[model samples]
Target chain A: MNDGTSATVTEIDMRNTSLRDLNRQLHEATSGHFVVTNPRGAHAVAAGIDSDIVVELRGSVGYYAAGMLQRGTVIVDGNAGTGVAENMMSGVARVTGSATMSAGATGCGGLLVIEGGAGARCGISMKGLDIVVGGDIGHMGAFMAQAGNLVVLGDADHHLGDSIYEADLFVRGDVASLGADCEEKEMSAEDVDLLTQLLERAQMTADPGDFRHFGSARQLYNFHPDDINSEVAEARS
Target chain B: MTGENWHQRESYTFDRNVIAEIHRAANTGIYRIRGFGAKRRLPTFDDLVFLGASMSRYPLEGYREDCGTDVIIGEGRAERPVHLDIPITIAGMSFGSLSAQAKEALGRGANAAGTSTTTGDGGMTPEERGHSKTLVYQYLPSRYGMNPDDIRKADAIEVVVGQGAKPGGGGMLLGQKITERVAEMRTLPEGIDQRSACRHPDWTGPDDLEIKILELREIVGWQVPVYVKIGAARPFYDTALAVKAGADAVVVDGMQGGTAATQDVFIEHVGIPTIAAVPEAVRAMKELGAHRDVKLIVAGGIRTGADVAKALALGADAVSLGTAALIAIGDNSPSLEDQYQALGTTAGCWEDYQDGTDPAGITTQDPELSARLDPVVAGRRLANYLQVLTLEVQTLARANGKSHVHNLEPDDLAALTVEAAAMAKVPLAGTSWIPGMG
Candidate 1:
């Protein structure tokens, strides 16, 4: 296991090493900086990492790359497939290129950074995750997002933060449309600080003032007695 | 002058129960939402009876003979497959739906029975995880309270596609049941009627499910078995697809399976019967040439030892229990008659599990109500019930000249009804005729 830059480096060539073997070796290591070469768009390239290690993948990865990551740093030099860094607990997952749908979906805790554009349903059902997207995101981004901070430097697609609860969403560029129970809220000082930290951590050039904050309107949280009455009236009409 | 001499006739078109339901709906302008499975009569295991040994076959002594009930699920695949002393397991019921004491009791009872108990949609609670010896973590659509550490602690993983109570529908935890703890775990506001998603956010259908299963296996290092569970909507194709999706085992829950809360219409009218589901699932597995290679666990309406034996005879590797286990743990107990009446229901007909005012304290979240159910006593009762079921299965197997419970086959059974004969692929009791067989 490599300790620092000067220590012995661990390199795994996916051409020779099996996925299971590679993950097994990674899981066994406590502290190391490993470089993965020739990934060839394989799924689960560096998944279930529970230690404080560094995993750098040279090529594009398939579905669920860096999935269920606990405590580690995952850097993907190329594009990622669906659910990149999905369900990660505590870690730092950075993708240099674009990612497919549901990036960081249902993640409990982690920092997910996508340098390029992301597909639809990005950060869906995100719980306590911090996401910073440098490029534009597709439709249904952060739908039903529970608790998290999503900072987008570029334009966002339609239905951003649909049915959101307690999560803070900030977008720099134009938002196509807001979804149900989502509305633009006045940005606070704390929100600005949070955005500044996330942007600085992601190393993306964007000012906190350039973005607008959006969050839950708290309308769809509970079922009121009037809701049923209105629904019944609508049905009859 | 007496009521008996009044000569009142009930209408066949609209029965009293049906009329009452309509009246209730008209008053509320909403459909009836309740718990429990279908209350209507359906073709069940009671329609088929095992043929005891006659002059053709010699019977073993019931008390002395040893009829084995052990089952090993996910053999040859997982590093640590689930090994059960009995074939019966406790089905998945969420912590948000059931009280902590009830979840603990289920785990404790399953432990005593030397079987496995599964965690449900709301994720694994510390009470259940600590109490259960063998636990199967359910990976559901909502992904509520899902933690990778809990997944690592599980003995097995169950990817829940659907439940039998409502096949195409999702789960519902009403506002009353969503307490502070429940809300915190689900990452939602308190007192919200949480409607869980019907499909996974990242994946859809079998092809994507295969990849999802791979990710799950990778998370756990392929140490434990992974089972895919499906509601009995399309048993044959669902089973085939689940097998093709690389499941170590398949759990098929039929129409009679219980739910914590669902629309009455969906519960009663959604899926096929348990007796019909088993044969079709077995057929699919047999055709895939993975009949015993991939184990099958059947659920829904499995109440007695006879039901367990019947499921095995129809080619199920094991069976799971939800409603019956709750009953054993004091749900709908006759002792709570006064309380049940106060809630506008009878002891045997208590189906207001969604309201969360359960008299027996098994379903409610109220501290005072939840305190009434003693976990130790309830667990012992469930253990006793499981023991009785196992004994009865062994007795039937021995009487049928079988050395093991799994050895009981369809040839050793006969149907009491034409519908049963056709569905079960068995001969009629007195006649040598099966409806579709030439």
Candidate 2:
């Protein structure tokens, strides 16, 4: 087992060993992709990895497939379970298939790409990261995004970009309604170029021309007494 | 209008010459005031905590014998959880609001009592950190005096989301109190009104707060425990979120808490009472399956030992004191009645912390006024009060068959009045009434 004292790659056969042993081996291995084949559904397969290594899970995995990843690439070949790629930082996490709700919730920085659909609150409160979802995202996507870029090829759910600030959003499909302080902005050539690069990085073939951008209008930063009085008066009326 | 009432109301009138003479007797400089300064009858935090041991309950020996009062906060998960010798900790009252001597005195008292003192919105002061054995460094939304060096130096980190005195509101320090040093610490212009941002500059909700926590952990290499301090609003949701965000402990401050300077309207009408907030926070911890695993520190209106015992019985791991600690260090004492009167207010009833007209020298920048307070004597008084509180809590705990003060449960408590019972979430007298019971 690599206990942070050594920098070496140690491989183990997933067929002969359990998911727990595989994860342990992967955690111990230094800076290389540990290939896994025919992996049955397993929970917490690769949790708390803090090294620059890659783990390629060949088959579908259970809940929290790549939870609390600090650095490294964790690629799930098939569909993943709940909290897939949760709180990942400074690495590329590419999920080939659909992910459950709360995907990439509170990710500080890193590139998380979902080839298939993602459930509710995708990229919620994403800070300084780039999330590219090829398929549609469920409700409350990019809610309270402080700073990041969320590019969705398909339609976005309700309350998209709620209470967002400075974060860039590009979606090709219909947006139900923009959240408070979030307004639609004209997409420029520079924006198109950025989208093209993001798509290439995420390994998606979506057209940048079809996408629309949304961002914060910068209201509600400071409260005004007149606004509160008006609201109270309206309630009274 | 009655004849008998009219006869009883017969009065004498003073001579016009005598009135003129009295008016002429009044001096022009600092002598025109009638009463003490700031005579408003505002309620302090101590007004809420009534002593519990009266006639029915058994009380322990005040001296000799052991009534343990030590507390382990942020244990297990926090990189550095503080182990205090006493339950009563000093609250975060800023350096700008109080003089350097006052801060030093508070630290000295807390150190003597084997507890910790907190740094406030202005940031860590050398006097506070030097005197305090255990010091809690506060990380406010403003990021004032925030750096990696201070984070590493702190015994614990308290992320202040809000305070009970003004839950949804930010802080405002007027120009009068912002000394050069205070201005330097907060990175603001000297002698100008400073308003701290209510929301955090870097993070939003608990979801993003996790990242901030991780960053702090990385910076400090996870040596000290992280505590999330929130004003008592929706205690259930806030507490649950704090725990979910990987906090080692949660500090829940109730409405009656004192502020160095806040609007009177916000202080009187902003948040829930301290007595009501404790049980709700305890319930939230229980719901998250982190009741005792994650420590709960309750504040606001915590005064004497009986109040400490009652709070512990109601499921608080420990209690913190601010105004009471200040009082023990000679704030609003009757001895300062002359100075208070000169300022048009009375001792034991002053709240003009926003104005720099303090007489006891505790909360002013004027060198002469601040020099009136002796840090060594004030520190001794505060230590004595802390000792009393520890003994009092221990006495009640022993009577209830609890070896340690933390072991006192709700069963050991009974409310005197319906209001007290409802507020404390305990059973009424001569009845089995538990609010959290399913």
Candidate 3:
């Protein structure tokens, strides 16, 4: 049906739907197998998809998959490339396998769940997204997160929540070290509740009691050389 | 030791003789002069604007009134949209010409003013990006730091065709400023003089430029607005071409604009004055039926609120500062008089930007010179200058019985001289005399 507003679900599968075509169809269509096959590390797969539609990728996807997504469910059957669900405003992006670097980076609002480990710079500059990883994440995870909940099940690499601002970070394993402006804060009951909720949303089985919260120390934003020098002197002392 | 002292003294005398000879040769047309053009004589773009107060335009009661200077360029439909709080912005002074510290100071100042600063022929720096809330990345013909990631990171993209100081000429970053990092960003050999290509490598004309814009828009996903910046030559044609090429805004830089390095002949002789360019650009936009719809930003000899008001009145949506912003950040502060003397120049009046011998550490690559400037303090000074400019513009607008600065019209302007009247295309003061007409 060539109606201005509607398209058939079968129409998507019949054509050699490129990533651009699929994205355009997803933007225009209300419901659609929307099968994206032959995805040879294609980027921005299912990007700008707003409607309540389901998109299935037959193979691995590339960077910024489902970027800036809103109000839809995106299911990736295989491993996802870098920046999966980046800057996503709202919706659910579920990856069945491991994710590459910068998963859910700068996602303002959404639920992103990675079943396996994420690469370096995971959730770097994340603003207000809920990221749950089932396995170990690489170094510099949750860097500069202003406001969001990041739940990691495995050991985090060095500089977790580096220079972060206000985003709640809950990690189950050992952290190598905190970056500048990031500090380890004791987990409270409310934090545990939030962690538990994130776990349940990601369908994770990890216990919330094993997690620790990390946040910004509120330093670096206001720079006073004298205060910094004194702190440096105190460290020497 | 005596012999060494004798040799040192002799060498000093010899060096002075050589310099004198060089100067003589330059004046006599023996040695071909290259770079350091417009900086030789007359007041720079920084000299005209002086901060005025309640006596001239109603000065803000300091903390009582809300004087807003925030402006958003290339917003809504362009490839990249930049949201800035202040109207004053740093003009494009390339990376190869300025030290990293100078660029950083520019960013710090612009950021403090809640405005955006631009990257020059050099690529984007982490320090500049981190400091600035909104950064407009330059896409010059040289493509020094042209990469998809930097373009995506930028709040707005400026496609620079030419500069006011030296139109149709390439940029040269001397070997002195070509530090390891600058070389790396530009992909040039370290310790070697780098010359940027005069024309863009990817595109040649407006038709191709439109495609290039589309490519950039596609890569950045059309979030940030794209601005096409041109030197004020053929303002009507260039402005129309830029608008036709899908530029969200067109920035017209006049002959009075500053450059880090350019041949003396080109700076003084080439390009039209900003006063003349503004009206032509606005006329082009009006003819295209996109006068205010597509933003027109004018830069060249824009110093004070009066100059800014004049530009807006003649049809510029906003004004950008290069030399003036640099001065506000302590480019030639009188406190560095001793250093200026040592450089054989005076503070508040040095223009040998090409020699890489700036005393304020603004235009030099020398580590000792660069370390003189502190980015934090410089940024604060720039913020103060921007605040003063906003207040002055607001005051002038009030005097003209206008609410917003953008509401000012050509009716508010009266040219002081016949030349100014002809050049500005406005009526003469105390008369109905309009130049270029009987």
Candidate 4:
């Protein structure tokens, strides 16, 4: 617990260290503040970190920089690569800069906040995580998203939220095009209240009234029993 | 009757099946899709003959001496490596392709034989997992039913880059097989055909694959072994790359391996034969000095105990069975002849496994059809078959005067045909000369 001593952050130099050893050490550690310096675009930096600690990575990173993250505060000082925080279950991942494709993809639970623009397929196949993107998002944003809330302050590129399910998508700026089965819906007062809280968590400023909400139409897959036309056909046959 | 004396001459280039395939393709405008391995005849273990000890070495007693059969997979990598009583392990077959009972049967049989069984494409089933003492969960390109929790529950993880039947092609689970449970697990609509992606979503090349292995190792705390399985397109390079990618075990699958669904053309045309594939993989391991250190498991058409013995003698640490395993679980039993007749196919001749109307109940998802085969009986049958195979291997080893099954080598074998001699790199019978060797 390190309760006996004053909380001291452990500094690690990433220039000559192995990521395998680094993640292993992180998994074993119960409580401590960790600072990773000179990441130098390392892939899988602090990956699979599951302890209740904090990690500050000080550089642009490569793919899966903080993948499958759980119970930690991971802050990337610069731009992150593909699949950053991918499949993360819990805790927080705050990126000071932008992220590449599939940012926060397939994450179950967590708060992933990107300050700058995100590349294509942001929040793809999201399970339950809440993502707040400050700037623009590229094509196919939240494609096939199953669950979670994606809030984008800036523009969204083509085919946003294609074949989405359950997940709610909110964009403030212009959308190039909407994808199949994803349609705009009336934003209730409840949505605005939720957006305001999420923005406050990300520490970003944006008017909740300006955002437009979009979600699945459930045309291909009907959630209700009465909506199953094929089952009825089979029953009649 | 008089005109029948003049029979029509058939062209050798365009045979009956070729003509039928062309017409079928023309009619359907799609390739012929089916299940099972290559139907065409190819060079196999039958071309090879064992050289029993006569005078040069004394043969061991029939029942007195013990020939060690126990094999330890993932020697240095895994924290808890699997200890197999025999060298034969059950190959991965998905739950969607085979009924849950069939999966359970495979697990029970492999477990009873003191070996391992693997899970394939659609993910782990509780019945299969519960029965299997040692289970290898396959992580495929599609990632269908893939989650971190299932990966954690597995004893070993096999990263499947390719399968033998469709090396460059994707996996196809037909609409008929897409039961409600399968649709839910794969996140697809019910009664719709599904195709697995050819490439992994996250990573790309071999370099990236190496990183993925490292990530998996870290995620599992290095407790379970990570295996890389590849089709036998180019065994030497593929085995070398898999070794370079830091695999605990490397599995090479030849053309004769079965699939749930694939194009018949691909099954017949793609990939090398098992006999041709083994030596190249062995050569790669030998070149890298990783022969025994990193385990080698060969699959495809490994049916009998002699096949297992031959694969081991050819430098593989173990062998895997898929089609044979299905047969053990009563896939084409003669007892199901009445049902097979109703399905319009003879027993042991059914290849339309993709249609999901299997009469034997091993490959069907229909509740009534799947209920025909009992797991306990099927499992016992498979266990008996495995025991016989193990005994046969032990007999061959004793005949060669080898004290252990692993000690069986090329010196105790010779090939009958020139191609077999060249492929197997063994001397021709009654001669000390290998065809290609100087």
lDDT of each: 0.91, 0.75, 0.75, 0.86
Per-model DockQ: 0.46, 0.03, 0.02, 0.18
Second chain TM-score, each model: 0.97, 0.86, 0.87, 0.97
lDDT at A86, model 4: 81
Q: After superposition, how far is residue A68 of candidate 2 from its true place, in Å?
A: 21
Candidate whose DockQ is highest: 1
Per-residue C-alpha lDDT of model 3 across residues A95-214, encoded as one tens digit per residue: 988998778866767899999988887776565789999998998887766668889999899888876766888889888878778998988888888898899989999889998889
What TM-scores do the predictions have? 0.94, 0.61, 0.61, 0.85
Model 3 residue A212 distance off true place after TM-score fit, in angstroms: 64
Tell me which residue pairs clash in candidate 2.
Answer: B36-B341, B36-B344, B36-B345, B37-B343, B37-B344, B37-B345, B38-B345, B79-B223, B80-B224, B80-B225
DockQ-derived CAPRI band for the predicted complex in model 4 = incorrect
Ranking 1 against 2 by lDDT, winner: 1
For residues B368-400, what per-residue lDDT tens digits would candidate 2 score against the true structure? 888888999999999999998887778768776
- What's the lDDT for candidate 1? 0.91
- Model 2 per-residue lDDT at B277: 83
The Cα error of candidate 3 at residue B394, in Å, is 0.8
* lDDT of candidate 1 over B1-438, digit per residue (tens): 348865666777887988997777665666778999988999999999999899987788999978899998878878999999998999999898999999999999999999999998898988889999999999988899998899999999999998998998888889899999888888888888887878787877898889888988888898999999999999999999999999999999999999999989999999998888999999999999999899999999999999999999999989999999999999999999999999988999999898889988898787788899999999999999999999999998899898888888888889999999988888989888999888
The residue ranges of model 1 lying beyond 4 angstroms of the native Cα positions read: A1-7, A225-237, B1-11, B436-438
The order of the candidates by TM-score, greatest first, is: 1, 4, 2, 3
| Positional deviation of residue A199's Cα in model 3 after best superposition, in angstroms | 52
**Model 4, span B240-271: residue lDDT tens:** 99999999889999999999989888999999
TM-score (chain B) for model 3? 0.87
List ranges where model 2 is wrong by over 4 Å. Answer: A1-237, B1-65, B433-438
